[model samples]
Target: MTRIVVVTGGTSGIGRAIAERFAADQAEVFVTGRHADTVELTAKELGVHGVVCDATAPGQVSSLAARLERVDVLVNAAGGLPETASGDVAPLNALLAQWHSSLAQNLLTAVLTTAAVQDRLTSGSSVISIGSIGAERRGGSYGAAKAALAAWNASLSAELAPRGVTCNVISAGYIADTNFFRGQMSDERQRTLVEETHNKRPGTVDDIAQTTCFLASPGARHITGQAIHVNGGAFTTR
Candidate 1:
C-alpha cells in the first residue's frame, strides 16, 4: 500500500524538501500550508495532495484529519521564528507577543495537529517533529519553544509506543539554502556557523529529510522518544 505521508508547513523550506523527498519515493503525500496559492503551487510541483490549513487552528486541523483514513507518517514541520510587527505597543506586551507567536508556531501547531490526526496513526506509524539546535544554546523564545517541542515528544512517545507508533524530534542545526533565517543572516554569521561545525559545513534539507524517512522505517521501530540532532557536530550529546 502507498503510505499516507502528511507534512505540515509544506509550502517551503524544510517542509517542502521533506514533501519532495517522499513524493520522489511514490508516497501518497499530503502537504499543508497557511496559504492557498503556495500550497497549490507546491502540491502541483511535487505531484502530491495539498491542503490550505493553519495547523494552529483546531477547526481546520479537524477538517484536515477528516480527509485521511490513515496517516502512516506525520511530519510536524510547521514552525519558524515569527516576524515581529512594527507596533507601538508596550515593551512587555511586545515581549509577550513574541513568546506567544513562537509557542503557537513551534509548539502548539505540533500539539494540535497530532491530537487531531493521531487516531489515524495506527501500528507502524511515526511522528517526526522538526526541532532546532537553538534549544541547546540560547535562542530566546524560539529556542524555548523548540525545547518544549522535544519535551512534548517525550510524553507523546510514551502514550503511543504501546500502539506501535513512534515519536521523535529531529533537532537540525544550521541548514544551508533555507528561508529559515528570513534573509537576515549576515555573511559573517553564516561563515561562523559553518566554521563551528565539525564537518565544516552547514546541514542540508536532505540530511533531515533522509533522517525523517529512516525514523519512519521499520528498522527505527525501537528509536522512539529521542531527539536526533543533525547539526554536523555543532552540538553533541551522547
Candidate 2:
C-alpha cells in the first residue's frame, strides 16, 4: 500500500530530505511551507504534493489538515530560529522577545499542527517531531522550546499509544547542508562542532531522514515517547 506521509517545513533542510526520501520510496508525500513559490517548487521537484501553510497559524494548520484524507506518518519539522524583531532595545526586552519567538516557532507550531491532525491519524501511524541538542546544552530560548517539545511528546505518546499510534522526538545535533546557520558559519566554528562529535564529522540530512523512515516502520512499533538523539556521539545518556 502507498503510505501517506505529511511533513511540515518540508521545503528545505532536514524536512526536505525526509520528504524526498519517502517520495523515493513511492510514498504519497504531502509537504507544507510558509511560501507558495517554495512549496510549489519543492513539491514539483520531489514529485509530491505541497501546500502553503504556516504551522504557527491555527487557521492555516487547520486548513492544511483538512487537505489530508489520511496520514500514515506525520513529521513535525516546521521549526527554526525565530526571526529577529525590534532590535536596539533593552537587554531584558530583547531576551523576552527571543524567548517568545522561539516558543512560538519551535513549540507551538508542533502543538497546533499535531492537534489539528490528531484525528486524521490512523492505526499504526507515527508522529515525529524534530528536536535539537540545544535542548541539552546552551540553547537558551531555542533549547527551552525544544525541551518543552520532548516533554509534550511524552504525554502525547501516552495518549496515542493506546490507539496503536506512536509519537516521539528526534533531537539532532550539528546537521550539515541546512540553512540553520544562515550561511554565517565560520570554518573554525564548523571544525569545533565536528571535533566535538566522537565520529569526527557533522550529521547529514540523509542520516536524519533514514532514521525517520526506520522509526515509522513496523520494526519500531515498540519505540514511543522517547527522545532519540542522532548527534553522532556528541552527547551521551545513561
Candidate 3:
C-alpha cells in the first residue's frame, strides 16, 4: 500500500526534500506551506498534494488535519528563526517577542499539528520531527525551541508507542543547499560550521531526507522516543 505522508513546511529546503523523497516512492504525499503560491508551485513541481497552512495557527492546523482521513507518516518540519523579530523595540519586549516567535515557530508548530492529527495517524505509523544541532550549543531562542522539540518527542513517543506508532526527532547539523539562513549566513560562518564537523563538509538535505525515510520504515519499528542526531559528528553525546 502506498503510504500517506504529510510534511509541514514542505514548500522548500529540508521539508521539500523529504516530501519529494516520499513522493518519488509513490506515496500519497501532501506538503504544506504558509504561502499559497509557493505551496501550489512546489506541489506542481514535486507532484504532491499542497495546502497553504500556517501550522502555528490552531484553526489552520485543525483544518488541515480534517482534510486527511488517514496518515501513515507525519514530518513536522515547519520552523525557522524569525526574520522580523530583531528590531527596534524596548529591549525587554524585543527579547520576549523573539522568544515567543521562536517557540511558536519551532516547538508549538509540531505540537499543534500533531495534536490535531493524532487521530488520523494509524498503527505502525511514524512521527518524525526535525531538530537542530544548535539545541546543544549557542542557539539562543532557536536552539531552546529545538531542545524543547526533543523533549516533546520523548513524551509523544511514549503516548504513541502503545498504538504501534513511533515518534522521533532528527537533530540535523549545518546542511547546505537551503534558505535556512535566509541569506544571512556568511561564507566564513559556513566554513566554520564545516570545520566543526568530523567529515569536514557540510551536510545535505538528502542526508536528512534519507534518514527520515528510514525511520518511517518498518525496520525502525523498535526505535521510538529517541532523538537521533544526524550531525556529522559536530555535536556527539557521550
Candidate 4:
C-alpha cells in the first residue's frame, strides 16, 4: 500500500530531504512550506503534493489537516533558529522574544501540527519530530525548546504507543548544506563544529533523511519515545 506522508517545512534543508526520501519510496507525499511559490516549486520538482501553510498558525495548520484524510507518517520537520534568538536586541526584550520565538518555532510547531493531525494518523503510523544537538549544549533558547520537544515526544509516545503509533525525536548535530546557517556561520565556527565530532565531519541531510525513513518503517515499530542521536558522535549518551 502506498503510504500517505505529511512533511511540514518540506521546501528546503532537512525537511526537504525527508520529503524526498519518502517520495523515493513511492509514498504519496504532501509537503508544506510557508511560501506558496517555494511549495509549488518543490512539489513540482519532487513529484509530490505541496501545500502552503505555516505550521505555527492555527488556521493554516487546520487547513493543512483538512486536506489530509489519512496519514501514515507525520514528520514534524518545521522549526528553526530565528535571528532574534541570537541577534542584538534590548537585553530584556531579547530574552523574552528569543524564548518565545524558539518555543513557537521548535516545540510548538510539532505540538500543534501533531494535534491537528492526530485523528488521521493510522494505527501503525510514525510521528517523527526533528530535534537538535543544541538542546544538549550551547543551544540557548532554541536548545531549550528542542529539549522541551523531547519531553513532549515522550508523552506523545506514551499516548500513541498503545495505538501502535510510534512517536520519536531525532537529535541532529551540525549539518552542512541548506540555508540553516543563513550564511552567518563563520568558517572558524564550522571547523570547530566539525572538529567536535568524532568523525571530524559535518552531517549530511541524507543522514537524517535515511534515519527518518527507517523509523517510519515497520522495523522501527518497537522504537518509540526515544531520542535517537545522529550527530556523528559529537555527543554521546550513556
Candidate 5:
C-alpha cells in the first residue's frame, strides 16, 4: 500500500523537495504551508494534496489533524530564521524580537503540529524534522530552537516507539535553492560555506528529500530518536 505522508512547510525548500520525493515514490503526499497560493500551486506541481496551515497556530493545527485520515509519515519542515519584527526597532530590541520569532517559527511550530497530529500517526510511522548545523556553531536563537527540537524528538521517539513510530531530526548544512538566503547570499559567503564542507559543495534540497524518504522506508525501521547530519562533513562530532 502507498504510504500517507504529511510535510509541513512543504511549499518550498527542503519540505517541498521531500514531498515531491515521496510522491515520486508513489506515496500519497500532503503538504502544508502558511500561504494558500504557494501551497496550492506546489501541490498541483507535485501532484500532491496541499493544505494551508500555520503550524504555530493551535487552532489551525488542530483542524489539520481532523482533516487527515491517516499520517504514515510526518515531516516537520516548517521552520526558518526569525523575521525582523517592526523593521525599525533598535538593535537590542530587534534581536530580542528575532529570538522570540525564531522560537515560534522553529521550535513551537513543530511541537504544536506534532501534538495536534500525534493521534493520526499509525504504526511504523516516522516523524522527520529539519534541523540545522547552526544549532551547533555560530547559531543564535534559531539554533537554540533547533537544539530544542532535537531534544524533544528524543523523548517523543521513546513515547512513540512502542507503537512502531520513529522520530528523527536531519541536521542539514548549507543548502542551496529555496528562499533560504532571502536573496542576500554573497558570492564570498557562498564560497566560504563550500570551502568549509569536506565535499567542497553545498547541499541540495534533493539530498534532504532522499534522506527523508529513506527514513520513512521500511529499511529504516530500526532507526529512531537520532539526529542525522547531512552537511558534507562541514561539522562532525565523534
Candidate 6:
C-alpha cells in the first residue's frame, strides 16, 4: 500500500523539498500552504495533492485533518522567522506581537496539526517537526518557540509511543538556497555561518530532506522523542 504523507508549509524551502522527496518515492503525498496559487502550482509541479491551510489557525488545521483518512507521516514544517510589524509606537506591544506570532507559527502549528490528525495515525506512523539550532542559542523569540517544540515533542512521544507512533524533531542549522533568511543575510554573515560548520559548507534542503525521509522509514522506528541535529557538526549534542 502507498504510504500517506502530509507536509505543511510545503510551498517552498525545506518543506517543499521534503514533499518532493516523498513524492519521488511514489508516496501519496499531500503538500500544504496558505496561498492557493502556490499550493496548486507546487502540487502540480510535484504531482502531489495540495492543501490550502494556515496551520496556525485551528479551524483551517482541523479542516486539513478532515481531508485525510489515514496518515503514515506528518511533517509539521509550517513555520518561519516571525515578521512582526515594525511601526508600532509601543515597545512592549511590538515585543508581544513578535513573541506571539513566533509561538503560534513555530510551536502551536505543530501542536494543533498533530492534535487534529493524531487519531488518523496508526501503528508505525511517524510525526516529524522542523526545529532550529537557534533553539540552542540566541534565537530570540523564534528559538524560544522551537525550544518549546522540542519540549512538547518529548511529552508527545511518551504519549504516542505506546500506540506505535514515533515523534521527533529535526533541528536544522543554516541551510542554503532557502527563503528562510528573507533577504536579510549579508554575504559576510553567510560566509560566517558556513565557516562555523565543521565541513566548511552550508547545509542544503536535500540534506535536511533526506534526513526527514530516513526518520520516517522503518529503520528509524527506534528513534523517537529526540532532537536529531543535522547541522554538519555546527551544533553537536555534546
lDDT of 5 by residue, 115-206 (tens): 98898888999999999999898888999999999999999999999999999999999999879879999999999999999999999999
**Per-residue lDDT of candidate 6, residues 55-82 (tens digit):** 9889999999999999999999999999
State each candidate's clash count.
0, 0, 0, 0, 0, 0
> Of the pair 1 and 3, which is ahead by TM-score?
1
Candidate 1 per-residue lDDT over residues 45-84, each given as its tens digit: 9999999999989999999999999999999999999658
lDDT of 2 by residue, 1-238 (tens): 8999999999999999999999999999999999999999999999999999999899999999998888899999988986676757998888788888899989998999999999989899999999999999999889999999999999999999999999999999999989988999999999999999999999999999999999999999999999999999998885
lDDT comparing candidate 2 with the true structure: 0.94
Give lDDT for model 3. 0.95
lDDT of each: 0.96, 0.94, 0.95, 0.94, 0.93, 0.96
lDDT, residue 193, candidate 4: 93
Screening candidate 5 with a backbone cut-off below 3 angstroms (N, C-alpha, C), the clashing residue pairs are none
Question: Could you tell which candidate, 2 or 5, scores higher by TM-score?
Answer: 2
Q: What lDDT is reached at residue 225 by model 5?
A: 96
Q: Regarding lDDT, does 2 or 3 come out ahead?
A: 3
Estimated TM-score per prediction?
A: 0.99, 0.97, 0.98, 0.97, 0.97, 0.99
Model 1 TM? 0.99
- Residue range 52-162, candidate 3, lDDT tens digits: 999999999999999998989999999999545555688788888889999999999999999999999889899999999989999999999999999999999999999
